[model samples]
Target chain A: MNPPLLDVRGLTLRYETDAGLVTATSRVSFQVNRSDRYVLLGPSGCGKSTLLKAVGGYLAPAEGQILLKGAPIRKPGPDRMMVFQEFDQLLPWCTVTQNVTFALTASGRLKAAEAEERARHYIAKVGLARFADRFPHTLSGGMKQRVAIARGMAMEPDILLMDEPYAALDALTRRSMQDELLQLWEEIRFTVLFVTHSIPEAIKLGTRILLLTPHPGRVKAEHRSDGTDPAGPDGELLSERIHRELFSDAREEEAGHV
Target chain B: MSDSGTVRLPLPAARTGAAPAQRRRVWRNSPLLRKACILLVLACVWQIYAVQLDKPLLFPTLTDTLQALWSSLASGALFTRIGFTLRTLLMGYAAGILLAGVVTALAVGSRLGNDLLETFTAMFNPLPAIALLPLSLLWFGLGNGSLIFVLVHSVLWPTALSTHAGFRAVSPTLRMVGRNYGLTGLRLVLRILVPAAFPSILTGLKNGWAFAWRTLIAAELVFGVSSGAGGLGWFIYENKNQLEIPSVFAGLLTVILIGLFVENLIFRTIERRTVRRWGMQA
Candidate 1:
């Protein structure tokens, strides 16, 4: 409607490895509106993470451009924050509060006192206020992810890029985190580009799902789940249906490639 | 998907106290303490033999050494020599550490710089700092400058090597996380790289200080001209020339005491504050 918040057009990525020039993704395009929860769903080596990296301006595309609020994404900026998959995403040397404050300070967004207050606010929001003085090494995997999420949200980025942020968590923790994330999204309404291979995660979280094909990854399909069901009892059924569809689509894509 | 969703089994709580208790029992029964006791017994035996031999010039008894140490402390000669040695050691150690950091930063920041550091360290690391005494004397003249020059040489390479290795070993994911936050150049290194590589860097600093201490003593012994008057090494050399064996032993004891102070106090405190607290090292 108003020139979507992010516009990625015909994006292609190739990596020069010791083996050969490998095409990671090809002609992949997507658009995300403001406050959209968009998920990129694909199998391993489908270049979903690469696509997320491209959006964050960490990786350059072989072809095509990513525009954020009409400005071409050239390099990484504070405007696009990332929650990495690794538990060590939070710097070990820094306490939770310091980790969040680092972003605010580094970006020159606020003075020390104000930055610290803002950091506390985000840490409290992520339910880690009690652990503010604790370093990352002392945190559990889920707790570390929460710190990462809090740090990202504290930056007040236009878009939050999560690269399979919950992939490292235990099953129960992953479900709890997903629920918490949805609750946080409802409150904040921040735009999110989440990458996950898990179909349940995509269906549960994404307003729109971009299904990608493996190796030289391309957009296989796009599913708008907002109208179907909004993660209730019926939502579980819809998730199952979507899961089957993704597998069949994946199999078909594999057959076509072979 | 089923396998992916399978419940993750929780690992048992790590047995933190058991190992220590077992280690304590073994240590109580082991030859380590017994050997130490035996060594103490041998030292007493040697002291008794020296006293029986009545050889003050050739071999000072333990009591004689203690008396010499006490007299030196009372006269303030021991304190003066210790102060001089500490000043030179600290100056050389600090300079060497700073130079190592600069070199490591340059090495990590660029490919050409990395090549230069590797080549230079390879060329110089093998040459013992003592061997450079003659060249250092020629360059800086016979003074504290020459001693400092050798100390710098001794401290720099080991620190640089360990630091470089630490920098190289930093996890890629951590590096990416730093980059994602738009950190680069000096800020990136100071904030992320240094802290992440702290355990190795601390190890390097400890080794560098030890080397600097040894080099300072050796250099001072060779060039005992009392450049800033005299250090502990020069004191020992002077006492030895005068056949003052007890005073030489006192000077040696002072060196040992200082080494113990630095290792157990300064470096131990640093390790406790950083690596141990961060859970990077035990």
Candidate 2:
């Protein structure tokens, strides 16, 4: 097998506050192979989002390093695009096509016409072809999130970092989004480092789940659900088992931490 | 989870219902009728009071005022005065808006710029632009330069304050999204920051326009010019001195008319096209 696409080691982060230094993450380590849907799961304030940010080069880890494709990660670039939790992630001023074109042009990967064509293609892929000329403000919450996803995917990043991209969506919409995401994953097969607190979401979406303990987060367990096809018949049983195991581990860890 | 334990769902509607024409008519008519009634009541009260006083110097009746207005329009003097005032106002408004943009950019871009803008706005925002007219006259002489100076003073602070507030109100998520698209510098400002802060900027523009209008008229009245190229304010002042009460009332009415045209036609149209359409403001 080929070596992992992303490798992180001994990662630690501390934020400076008026009160004092607050530790957010400690000695977190992980590796994500190409085409791996790696979900980081933990309760709120567990530094899962921080870890994703660090990996995406939005934040610097106080200790250790992250290597992407044998190169050390430094600052944020088009190679790692992020989809934030808020539906407002798509800039309200931009039409759907412009939002995607913005990413393509800014990356300097294509000329204006070519970038527009690619933007149209991705906007279509995300089922937003009709909304290409519409501003984000006019879109429903689910549609806005899809636009954000299209914008991220339009960059064709080495790793897509999602910080609870569907946590804000209503349950029905969230489920539809998950199915769409899985369909997109099947087509594109890009490495993804997704952060979410939901057990079912992790089992349904992630090929590998990295469970972290809350408050100064550290990896508690890693579960591989590679064979579980969430949309298949037997997938429900496997998802339930994964959910049970993850929640139990989370509970035990929380009890131990307290 | 099986369909066997569940009740069958109802069929979806085949067609969506359209809004009733009467409902649309009512929605359109109520606001217009209400405003017209209010204006009629105010005019009746004013006409009654003017007749009771029976002093043309003190107050002119609405019909007399309307007659004066008609005469001014027929002679083209009112149009010329309005054109002059509007020209000065547009120039000052444009300059003030440009300055506010620069100041806001500096404030958002650097610490020192932020401090400078904050201090400058705090110092000047509360000072009336009319009060600055004496100093402006001394510095620039009693010409259009002085009037423009006072107008700029009137417009700049409120525009800057609102713009800065808008910039500060932009959410972190939106900023992150812009960055994710590799947007920075001028592109970032134009695409993300400007639109996100637009509602506030629109408010600032409206306030600044009102201030500049009021300041221009007051300043022009205080320093009435002898040249034929004087504004509505000068027209009002000259008519008042000559005891032409009806013309003075006409000049005042012209000012109100211009203000109404700008507010309802220009600014309202822009608000509807942008912020209201975007649902950022009503």
Candidate 3:
């Protein structure tokens, strides 16, 4: 079998603050194959976002390593494009088209005309052709996320790393965005490493969900979800099953302590 | 269950012809129009007061100052003085900006550079630029050298300080984005940091310009009699010595007009086109 597109093994991430050292994640291991919508599902402080940042090369692993195409990751590169949740991710100075094109040109991936053409094509795919010349501040949060996604997709990176790209959107917008993302995935079948706390979002978008526990996040379980099964064994909903799997450990620990 | 009954009221009457007046109000409130009105009022008061005082030696009338300004302008003497001053100002200002750029670049680059900049700015920023006049005069021995020295002093500290503050304030996300795209060092500073910090940098430049202008005028007024090739400040001093009070007022008027031109025409236009258009500022 061909090697997985991304292989993260025993990756431990730490960051420093005014107080002291913070161990965000410890000895986490995962593999994302080509075209896999791999979701890191966890509650806040689970260090899922930090894991994503480590993959993006923004944070160094305190232990273990992240391998892309069997090569160890060193620093952030165009090969792993990131979509941040903040609307300010788009350069306020650049218009929507320019924002997408900037990534292409800045990475030296494409020439001016070709980059602009590809940027516009991706922008049209994301339904922002009308706002091609509008600044980021002018666009709504959902539209800005679309622009960010288009920028990431336009790069045709080895894997797209999204850190709650739609978590800040309204419920209606988030739903439509999920649908649009699925549609895009259908068209391109690009590999994605998505991080989110929303269970339904995990089921809806991810083909493989990696559940993580909080307080120095460790992988709890990995579930294969086609998002087609509403019910698991014993007539329980899949979301409920996943929820039980997540919190049941905490409940057991509490019972053991009692 | 609520006790209050629902009562419906008739629709309000439609407005009659207030749109034109509101539109006119918008036009009337334009910055240029309002500023012009204030200027007209101030000039009227100036004329009235000067006429009532009836002492041309102490306080000249608005017409007298204008007449003096017109005669000087026509004779082209005022132009020469203005040109000399502006030329000197530009030289010092350009040098100051270049030095500030280097200092700020260093400050952002490393801890040592940051320490150096912080220490130097703290020591010199509060000391008035004019205070350096005597020391500069002692070292450079009069003429435009000392004058330029003082001008650079005025421009450097504030420019460096504000620019450093601006660079420090650039958002981490923006910096990360720049780095994510393979941009590093000078490219990152130019493409990301500079534009992000421009509003503050512009503020610094404005402060530097004001400081440099004031310092130059004061320095020239004191000892700018260098080989009789002095600037507007020298011109004002010479006119005062000769008891040409009207001409002194004219020189002062010329200074005010130039200040207004730089602030309104140059700086305002830049602010409008860049920061305001970018929505970084309102």
Instruction: Sort all candidates by TM-score, best to worst.
Output: 3, 1, 2
Cα lDDT, all candidates:
0.87, 0.86, 0.91
lDDT of 2 by residue, B1-282 (tens): 568434333222212223456666776879978788799999999899998889978899988999999999999988988888888889998998998888888898899999999999999998999999889889998788888888888999999999999999999887776666667778878878888999999999999999999999998899857355888999999899999999999999889988999999999999988887777882
DockQ of each: 0.49, 0.42, 0.54
Sliding window of 10 residues with minimal summed lDDT for model 1 chain A: A227-236
Per-residue CA lDDT of model 2 for A1-258, tens digit only, reads 787799999999888889998788999999999999999988888899888888777788899889999898887778899999987777665688988887788667678899999899999999999989997788899998898888888888999999999999999999999999999999999889999998888888999999887678888778887645343365556556555555677778779999
State the lDDT of candidate 1 residue by residue for A1-258, as single tens digits: 589999999999888899999888999999999999999998888899999888888788899989999898988878999998988777787889999998888777778899999999999998999999998898899999999999999989999999999998899999999999999999999999999998878878999999887877888788876534445455556666666666777777679999
Looking only at chain A, give the TM-score of model 1 against the true structure: 0.92
Model 2 residue runs over 4 Å out of place are A227-258, B1-30, B37-57, B226-228
* Candidate 3 structure quality by residue, lDDT tens digits, A1-258: 899999999989999999899999989999999999999999998999999999999898899999999999999999999999887788877889999998899889999999999999999999999999998878899999999999999999999999999989999999999999999999999999999999999999999999998878999999999866577668998888879878888789789999
RMSD of each: 9.2, 8.6, 5.2
Output the TM-score of candidate 2: 0.86
